[model samples]
Target: MFKGALDNIPDRVKVFLLSLTIMFCMISTVYANFYIGIDKVYTHIFYVPIILAGIWYRRKAIYVALGLGLFYIVACTVHDSIIDPDTILRFLIFLVVAGVVGSLSRARERFHSKELQAERAFRRVAKDLQLVLESTDEGIYTTDIEGRCTLINVAGARMLGYGTEEIPGRKMHQLIHHTRANGTPCPAEECCVSRSRITGVGCRISDDIFWRKDGTAFPVEYSSYPIISDEAVIGSVVAFRDITKRKQADEVRSRLAAIVESTDDAIIGTTLDGIVTTWNAGAERIYGYTAKEIIGRHISLTAPPDVKDEIAGILGRIRSGGRFEHYETVRRKKDGALINVSLTISPIVNNAGDITGASAIARDITENKRVERELQEAKAQAEMYNDLLSHDINNINQIGTGYLELALSAPNLDRGVRELLDRSLEALQNSSRLIHNVRKMQEMKATAGKLAPVDICPLLDEIRAEYSGARNGEVRIDLACGNHTRAMANDLLKEVFSNIVGNAIKHSAGPVHVGIASEEISLNNKTYCKVSVEDNGPGIPDDLKPKLFSRFQRGNTKASGRGLGLYLVKNLVEGYGGRVSVEDRVAGDPSKGSRFVIMLPASA
Candidate 1:
């Protein structure tokens, strides 16, 4: 009851009470000194108020000591007492006690004030720590060295499938971690939290399992941190989180890696600078280099010297995030043999979507390339044989024609023999035409080069003069062309016109009238030169016209020569980036003869 009353007293009231006590003590001392003839005995009572004031008021204790000393001096003088050495000594003692006690009290008050501030700071920190523990998703709890749960946050209680009323004061390991993941015994002594308390060090376990209140277990990644006080291990804090998703992701990656290892194609990984970083078993079988032998080596080790630039180009593209599919190239094997390979390369990206390296799958295409080359060689050989046979047959036909001409020119030759020789000569001419066409077809297949500008007007005139002179007065040839009629064509342009015009004259029954005209035309926004060759012969039937440009196809049975003339003309014209077609000279009249139209790109 006294302690409670002291705590309730205000500072001013306490000071008033102390002053009243000091005044009472001073009066009693004066009464005892003067009336009772006692000096030191009653003066000792003054020490009580002085010491109480020092303890209560700190520096203000000096005023009480000084007040009591002045009263004693005034009382001594009033009582007819002379000031003696003892009195002076007693006055000095009052001042000394006030100074000493006041100074000590001030120091103690300063110390007490600092301690109060420190206590307030500690309270704020504790509040903040509690807020953090309750807010986080991770399970957090503390346990004593004996494995008893001292405190558990809301998250910890929920994570262990327990309520707030049920979690605390229970044995922690027995409540949530009594058994291992595989249903084996896990006592409290062997628990990670207990071990941390004993060892005074933190413990972390990634692949461990923690049981819930329902007797079910889940994979967990957890850390146990020992809480120390006064250099002694007191308890431990365990922070844990579920890791089921992480384990699932690791399993998926393992399966994908297994598939890559089992594939037959060579799978390799290289850094952006072309240094080999990964090589699978397929790479060892295909390139004859194991991962131990080739990893960290430059990718150029497998590339032929001639294809080094090719490898560099591939790396450059991959670095720019470009992917290549089925890129066929050549590489060198371990045995110094060159092999063809088809490569599919893609960039390897990191989590930040930055290109770090490249992955490539290479397939051996050597056998495919070998078969292609063999087929090409066989085709070339067949063409060579065809060219030789055509040349030989043309020579024989020319010899037979020459003999027939000589025999027909005899002065006394019989009419019947002349008629028979003329028929044989015509047959020989037909055979010669077939041979010539075959040779031209072969030349067209083998020729390579771009077409040049050829003046259409002059080429047409030359053909007209030659054909007219050959027929003497039997045919009439007319040419109509502008001065600057030029087309993108080569020397074969003349042969194209020769076949068209010659066919017109040969297929005509009476005097043939062949007219050639050239003009500029626009097709598909591009300029081209259109040349037309018209004759007054039997026009092609609608049904046969479609096949007129086909090899060995004749428009009519009455036609006199091999039917390769129009076919050769179309192939040669189109080879110069031109188009050729035949139409009736007069639209709807089959008897008006045919007109062959040729279109070639106009030279700028």
Candidate 2:
């Protein structure tokens, strides 16, 4: 093959044939008329191809061309006379041409070969670039300023669910329509691609949904770079990627966030540096700070001053990818009120299982604190009253029983003795009634358990029977309770009625009337039952009514038993998911006496 390439050269070498023709013509002209100067036109024919071939071909080809020129000179010289001036000049010129062409041709050949190699290298690079662009998984498409598709890689075509025939000349907008996920058109009027095409380079539109040829929607992220030539935007190149999975994950995250914000518990998130990143609606209501005010602030701002070290430790643990559970602490609200909150904090992590930040959920226990304080105070008072009742009632019973024993043992007892015995019996019964009242107050102090709905009527009847057994002839007990009476705790209901009836008998100079009523009311998105116990006795003093339910407090000093009778009544009434307050029966009826109202939760 190599020999064939050279064999195809013309039969006569260009240099030899030209040189021979020139020498023959020169010799003939010299002989024919002894002409003085020659035009030397044929000399040029010999020199030009030799120089060109030397610049274009390799060293060997250049030497062959020179040899042909030498052969022509030798042949022409043999036929002509020796030592002639014209012949000498022709030979000299031929020698000069041969030397210049041979030397320069070799150098030129090397330079020209190097240049050709560079061109080939550039072509290879271009081919490689095409392969890379075509093979990438991400879709690549370039467009012109007129919104026409200028180029689409194989990946781009496949991404739009199209073949090559459908893509090359198609307009970009026609092949793939742009719209919001909600189906709103994202046309030229609102498209960043269109806007950037008219304005400048490096503009982008994110979170857009592209409808493919198959009529299926997919999320896309695209960046457009305007191609400028001579200070004008000739076209744009868009690099796009499918982000359907990313968008779906974002939607799921948004839904879960909404659920957390809707809950009653406070939910919040912080960065690795303990900076608050997110705050929910429940946090707003509990902490008294709006999301706008709290986001991006340090989480330490919500922590109590004393708990800063504690919070720092917790954050350190979270940064180390540890979870902190049920850490009870006091958090300060925007209003400067200290809140008792139960906190659960955990490390928020990425797919690689690296700690990104921390998230916390807090539950408010302010009302629970208030109830605990009230309970403690009620307990202290009950113990004091119980001690007093045990002492006073026992003393009273001992004296009355001692007098009765003396009368029974005396054989010849006088009328005076009988009268004294009757008086003693009456005093003993009064002591028994006071002791019964003390027992009811003790029962009230018992902690309430899980509540179950109970009818109040039967509970009150029992109180009536217990009180009737102990009452002296001076007092009459009556039971007039509404049939609809219902409440949560049976023990609380009994305590309430017992305290009220006992109070009436202790303070009243004569007959005491007890009346119980119930009704329904709406509160906190639920219905509740309100039960009121009214008594016809000397009304509670205005100054004492406010603290009527306070510990170690008594309505009347002369009344038997400890002061906790009323306080216990109040606590028991409120403890069983109810509230109690004392008011006059008839606004102005101080004479008509005191009425205690109680509110209880009812079944949904």
Candidate 3:
């Protein structure tokens, strides 16, 4: 009740004034016949302001009360009829009692105020710390000594699926369903929160699964420290952080490391400071250096002296966001033997998406290079013979056709001779179609011309609709290209795609379906326009695929005439600077026909 009354004063000055008034009233009793009677209980009212002022104003109120008590006693002495030792002693005793009470009350008030200030300051610091913790992207949570939640930051709340309002003052261990990252339970005895309460220090904990509000689980890392007061454990502040992303990244890194280690190509990495950071098993096999021996060492140690300039150039390009692909070079191995290697170097990007270092994948292509050279020599000799045969065949066919016509027009020819001449012309027609295949093979191998931009979507549609309309078939043309795509010459694309569609229509036993699509593709840092023609028909036999693109090769020689459609397609496409290949349609069953892909440069 007294605390409530003292609470009214807003300032220390008001407390001092109130204390003075009460002290004056208390002294009035001392002068009233100097009779300090039980009615002096009224003087106890003066204790009100004395206690209030002491608690509120401290030393200031104590001094005012003491002065008021003494002044009252001096005024009583001057106004009274007689001066007596008992009166003086009584006045002195009263003065001492008032002073003692004021002093004691003031002391207690100072102590209480200091404690209140300390508490306010602590709360302020906590507010600021909480703001900082929540603002960070990392998860943070705090638990008390009894393993109850005192605070959980926003990031922590999101990670654990528990809000601060939902978990604070609640025992965290009971609510948190602990498990391993792989979903196995983490037994209560080994839990970090329980252990931290027993040990009054901070320690790192790993591989714990934290439960979500909906009962789902995610991995987290827990670090806990006990809060001590007066050398005794009061509570603990445990910081729990969700390490799911970190763990995932670690798994990916491990997988990538395993891939590089198991590969035949040498994979090595260096830090920006020039020290080797990673050396895989492939590196060990090729370079003859154990990973333990070379790691943490400079890469320049094994580099050949002549390659110093090349290495500098590669590093410069990588720093400028360029990749080095198929860069053939020589390097000395640990055995002091020079080895030929094809190096592919790229930048190793950090979490901030900046290149922090570089990686090199080295392939020993010495045998491959040697075999490729031999193959080129053999192919040149064979092509030379084929071209000569095609030229000779063409000349013979022209001479035979001209002579047959000239012989038939002779004035004295008999009906029997005319019939023989007609039979010979029919045989020559069959021979001429066979010769066209050889000519096509030579054309396909000829040097290509510069690629010019051509749009072939409309042309493809035109051919499909025209053929379908002419044949009056149920086959449908599905044109999926919306945007205009540019490729090589129109005539070349038309020849290739028309042959592919025509082949599909001929081979299909039922209603044929055709689809055309175009897109841009990048390969070896160069972009190209790609067009695909797909059909639903009987698939090509695996045995026939070897000769599928060769001249005079046909799936059904009876239905597909002359075996020159695809042969002509191959020649025309290559002459315009493009490539042609086949694959199964994505949506079609294995029984259905396949798709043929034609990749051409958008422009030279």
RMSD of each: 9.6, 17.2, 12.6
lDDT of 2 by residue, 1-604 (tens): 6333443566467456545654554455445433544432234444544544443343434454545455445544544534446645654665565556656766655676898899899999989988988888878777787888878888878888987567765667755766667877766746666667788747777777667788998888888788898999887777788988888899999999789879989888989888888898999999999989989899888888888788789989988878867877799999889999889999999999899999999999888888999999998898888889788878878877887887768888888878778766756865675576656655655545657778766776777677763455555556666546566776556667776777777777666666666677778886677767777788887888888778867776455444666776777766776788889987966667888877877654
Candidate 2 residue runs with Cα over 4 Å from true position: 1-81, 96-115, 143-150, 178-203, 226-235, 256-263, 270-281, 288-320, 329-338, 350-357, 369-604
Question: Per-prediction TM-score, please?
Answer: 0.56, 0.48, 0.57
List, residue by residue over 1-604, the lDDT tens digit for candidate 1.
6533553688888878887888788668667766788644346777777776776776788888888877767766666457666666777788778778778877876877888889888998999999999999888888877877888888878877888678878888777788887788998777778889999989888888888888888888899999999999888889998788899999999997998899988999999999999999988888898899999999999999988988889999998889999999998988888889999999999999999999999998898899999999998898788878777878889899999999899898888888899899999988987777777776776664557889999899899889984566889899989667899877777889999898888788878899999999788999999999999998788888888999878768465676788888888887888889989999989789999999998999
* Per-residue error (Å), model 1, residue 282: 4.4
Instruction: Give, for candidate 2, the lowest lDDT window spanning 10 residues.
Output: 33-42
Displacement of the residue 500 alpha carbon in candidate 2, Å: 42
Lowest-sum lDDT 10-residue window in model 3: 36-45
Q: Highest TM-score, which number?
A: 3
lDDT of 2 at 17: 55
